[model samples]
Target: MTILHLALADDWTAAVDAGEYRVSTLGRTLAQEGFIHACADLEQLRGVAGRYYGEVTEPLVVLAIDEELVGCPVVREIPEGAQEAFPHIYGPLPVSAVVQVTPFRR
Candidate 1:
């Protein structure tokens, strides 16, 4: 059960410096949608990047999160009757939860 999140290099750096990372798309807070968005696996991650960040040219990074170190709840969400689910964090993600950070380039 590996879940990942894509973040701009600078954003991730800032999060590490601040000790927390918040969802960026919707007001940069969990209150906007109640969770921090994430992808279930590589394929799903690529799809999300293609769909929403295709035009992005800035350096990016793939954050590999260790759920137990998250310091908060991690949930998998799918629509009613849907088979595929996405991973989301119920609160801000601490830098410690991210076990690995890899450069993301298309």
Candidate 2:
């Protein structure tokens, strides 16, 4: 299994096309933890920024992760070498464009 952290909707869509079960955002499901706001349009992301946190003025960024390929327990404790590649797009990311399949959580 491979967990792919995406910074854009297209990224997630591409993964789906490639035959993967992408986990909806944390906002969509409670079992899925974290916040990702990336959308087709930049404005949509900006509009929803407030819903995620208070006292916000500028647009926010969001991303999605492929949970099925990613494997269990949403959260993870990543290692150092892998950490450099997986820059946190939003909250704590489980994978990245360059990195995947970290030590599983839970």
lDDT of 2 by residue, 21-83 (tens): 234443342126343323322243343343343453333224434444333344443325433
Across 1-106, the per-residue lDDT of candidate 1 in tens digits comes to 5579988888889888999987644226667777888988999888779977888888889999988888888888894654689888989998888999999977
Point to the candidate with the largest lDDT: 1
Cα lDDT of candidate 1 equals 0.82
Clashes counted in candidate 2 amount to 4
Candidate RMSDs in Å, in order, are: 2.3, 14.3
Q: Which regions of candidate 2 are displaced past 4 Å?
A: 1-38, 56-94, 97-106
Alpha-carbon lDDT, every model: 0.82, 0.35
- Model 1 TM-score is 0.86
Q: Which stretches of candidate 1 lie over 4 Å from their true place?
A: 24-28, 79-83
Worst 10 residues of 1 by lDDT: 22-31
